[model samples]
Target: MAKSGNKMATLLNLILVLSLVLMISIAESRKLGEEAVACDSVYGAEEGDTCESVIQKFQLGADFFLSINPNLNCDNFFVGQWLCTEGTVN
Candidate 1:
């Protein structure tokens, strides 16, 4: 019974450690994505990409994005669309 309990405790500890590592890895990837340089650069829209997500990834405000990209359809996203990022950067 004691050995079984110890095994369970070790398994629980391993699970916790793995969970923490996975969380950290996810966070780091998000951080790297958010650090993209969009200022004065033209970005091509990828599949499943949204204008809001792109703006957020570049740390841009809606107003700033609009000012740089005149006549842009920000409400809808199209793959292969070119986006100008003049005043938007992380």
Candidate 2:
């Protein structure tokens, strides 16, 4: 009857919410693992430091800089941000 249909819909909604939570948890775990990088050297950003400036100062290749700092957004980079001058992504 109507009551039974309502119960079924509620149960389905609960299941859907739980499934979404599980998916989010899995995605977050994977992201953490991917972002884990071990740094041999680090550099703190100063005023007027662009990605290019940092790379040139350290004599680093563009590709190498990107590899070490996988999550870096060059356009929005801020002063006081610490970057890996030498590192390996795990």
Candidate 3:
């Protein structure tokens, strides 16, 4: 009985650890995606690109860019990055 209880406890601990790791990984991935610089426009976004260039390509202004990507920095952009900027009104 004691051995079974220990095994259950170990299993529960393992599950908890795995859950934490998964949560951390998900958060990290979201951060990386945010750090990336892709436009959220369905019309003009490729797999690897930056939102800055996309906004330029689309002829959008700085305010428009900010309105679109609230979490992004206009000055700093990265290559092969993607950003979500939908539902933003000009």
Name the weakest run of 10 consecutive residues (lDDT summed) in model 2: 28-37
**What tens-digit string does per-residue lDDT give for candidate 2 at 6-90?**
9999999999999999999998777544556788999989988889999999999999899999888888778889989998866
Task: Name the lDDT value of residue 70 in candidate 2.
Answer: 88
Estimate the Cα RMSD of every predicted model relative to the unseen true structure: 11.5, 5.4, 8.0
**What TM-score does each of the candidates earn?**
0.47, 0.59, 0.39
lDDT of each: 0.77, 0.89, 0.64
Instruction: For model 1, name the residue pairs that clash.
Output: none
By lDDT: ranked, best first: 2, 1, 3
lDDT for each residue of candidate 3 in 23-90, tens digit (9 for 90 to 100): 99998767443433345464434644566666677676756666666766645656544555444442
Q: Could you say which candidate leads in lDDT?
A: 2
Q: How do these models rank on TM-score, best leading?
A: 2, 1, 3
Give lDDT: candidate 3, residue 54. 69
TM-score of candidate 3 versus the correct structure, residues matched by position: 0.39
- Candidate 1's C-alpha runs over 4 A off are 1-39, 87-90
